[model samples]
Target chain A: MDDLHSPDPTEQSWGSLLRTNREEVLEKWTQTAAANLGGRMTPAEMGRDVDEIYSALVRADTGDQIDIRSAAYADLRSLLTELSRTRARQGFSPTETAVGVYALKDAVLEILEAHGDLPGYRAFARLSRIVDDLGMFMLETYATTREAVIAEQAEALLELSTPVVKLWDGIVALPLVGTLDSARTQVVMEALLQTLVDTGSEHAIIDITGVPAVDTQVAQHLLKTVQAARLLGAECIISGIRPQIAQTVVALGIEFGDIHTKASLADAILLAMRRSGLDVVKSR
Target chain B: MDRIPILRIGDVLLVSIQIDLQDQTALALQDDLSSKIVETGAKGVLIDISALEIVDSFIGRMISTTAAVSRVLDAETVVVGMQPAVAITLVELGLTLDGVRTALDVDRGLALLSSALGKAGSDVEVDDLAHE
Candidate 1:
């Protein structure tokens, strides 16, 4: 909306006149922010943040600067980004942050109305559009940053959940305890294969005793894990074949091929020990 | 013409494939191994493929053929020292190399051969005892 070479006289004068009532607009903006902020922040901190953006806008000679994407609003864009990220980290909602920007329209309009020598209708339209654009930028940045934070947290949680343990000499156990998905399956396979190499174990017992249910995808993931173990010359024995799971497996007609499956972890471990040439004799 | 050398170690012919195998080299190794097993009358063949990072279908088929040919000649073939990445890739390639037996390393492969030999020795002892 602004022309750098041919400055609109009315637009230039509006910006010049705006500086005269800067203190009054700053006061009203902080009051509206304090009222809307609702105890989340002290009035002093809220006032300080609003003061910085207000001076930048007035100095940018934001008369007729309606288009936020234009070079004229570059400083405003960066300022809003910093504000949105800080508020996102502070656990403030997007609407709350956007409303802080939106509340500016009322404060500025009131200040201009009291000055009787207001700009023409065209200049007023440009000022209103600028505030609207700033509000939209704040909401957009808040949403995008919040989603990124959630995704990072999920990845960290996945790493924590998958754990590989060496159960005995020449034997390792991967006790799975949640719903299996492709992403988690990749982690499980890599962990199991690495431990198999580290321990040089001949047999690995994958106990899914804590697994909630099974489906075609889960079965496929399990098969991939078993196949990978076998490639390393380590035999895989699936444990926790509960009757319900057995029924589901049979109903699905899923053939496990030559991969071993046992009814319980104890049975699987015993089989693994036997294959590793351990004879567990009962003490009489 | 990178011919993978086949060495006769006692009753087992040890072949370590330590090259980026071309199709001809793999086929030549298969032919050389089969003839060596027959000429030495070796009871077992140990193939150390730890250096074979990629096992494409042609190389895979050559190994399977060698195993089949040796089995017909009363010899057992065990491929050993396969890397974990190669194994995972081979499985993904849908070539499990099912017809052949495998071991983690040369030591385990030797142990596997000796244990079977030991079992054969006991069978002979039992036969002599039965005759007596």
Candidate 2:
């Protein structure tokens, strides 16, 4: 009959058996600790702790008589929980929180190592569940914060604005200075069109020397706004064609033949004046 | 996204366009631009493209259509802030837009409108001279 209380000589040398068992215990403890501590422990630190626990377990030997099982598992769990709470308050990242949980797993493993033949395996199993729960909680909390940060940034970008100028005779001039997006595009369109009606201007000028580049979508939006303006009996004049923009238009194969274009706002104004039948020399 | 006023420059309204103009936003923007044009009696409309990175076929068509509509209303349409890379990409993609005026910058566009207004005034002067 196999003896349950004593180490088996054929199964493993005493020292080797103790060493292997200690390692398994320490591994479990470190995992548990990592989970309970909100996974904030680093892998290097956890490794050191595992080594220390293994050495301690291997050195303790009571043969077949001593009961090495203790309530150390519960103690380790509480300690890890405190550590996790502290780390959470400090705003640890998800990776760091995961490390804390692993630390607790290591501690639990150490306890198991000391009670290799004990009947308290059931208790250790229960402790495993607690470690898992802590890990999940940390992950959920981290995700929520990350999402909130993204939303805040998007809202901030939407609130930005720029200044513009309008001529008394019904021409509007918008000097674009920075980057543009669909959201900003919509805002610019509404403001300009509304200004057109409010001002009763028949002409509008858009100078883009400050604009860095144009995408296909942006080009299309400009087209849409122009068409929309036509419905209201207004005309759009485009000016300030930097050499780069001209080249880009040519390369893209987008034809602006029918659309009115000028090298500068001065040229656009001349065209608008000619169409309106007003001479700048006489008006001044 | 709801249409919001981004900025005002002279009699030209500069609006930041969100929502795909080819989708629901196009019709909404059309309606809004039409009403604003009537309400403001704006001389011109400048569409800023610094924000849009991609222009699809439907969007291109809508832009052309907007220009036509604006012309019927007696308003001019100008498209501004077209990135060179985007222009190249669109052309390579085989997208073509017609009847839409383009400006490199807002100042030049406004100047064009100003000149148009000046010309209209001259035409009025000519009419007066003819009558006298």
- Highest DockQ, which number? 1
Q: lDDT of candidate 2? A: 0.58
Identify the runs in model 2 with alpha carbons over 4 angstroms from their true place.
A1-93, A97-103, A110-130, A161-171, A175-181, A199-201, A239-241, A262-284, B1-132
Candidate 2, which CAPRI tier? incorrect
What lDDT tens digits, residue by residue, belong to model 2 across residues A147-235? 66667766675455534468547678766655667777666666666666556666777776666886666566666555545434466
TM-score of each: 0.84, 0.43
DockQ each candidate and list the results.
Answer: 0.25, 0.05
Stretches off by above 4 angstroms in model 1 are A1-18, A62-72, A110-121, A278-284, B117-132
Per-residue C-alpha lDDT of model 2 across residues B21-60, encoded as one tens digit per residue: 4456776677777778877887778776645666676666
Question: Number of backbone collisions per candidate, in order?
Answer: 0, 138
| Candidate maximizing TM-score | 1
What is each predicted model's overall lDDT from 0 to 1? 0.77, 0.58
Cα-lDDT of candidate 1: 0.77
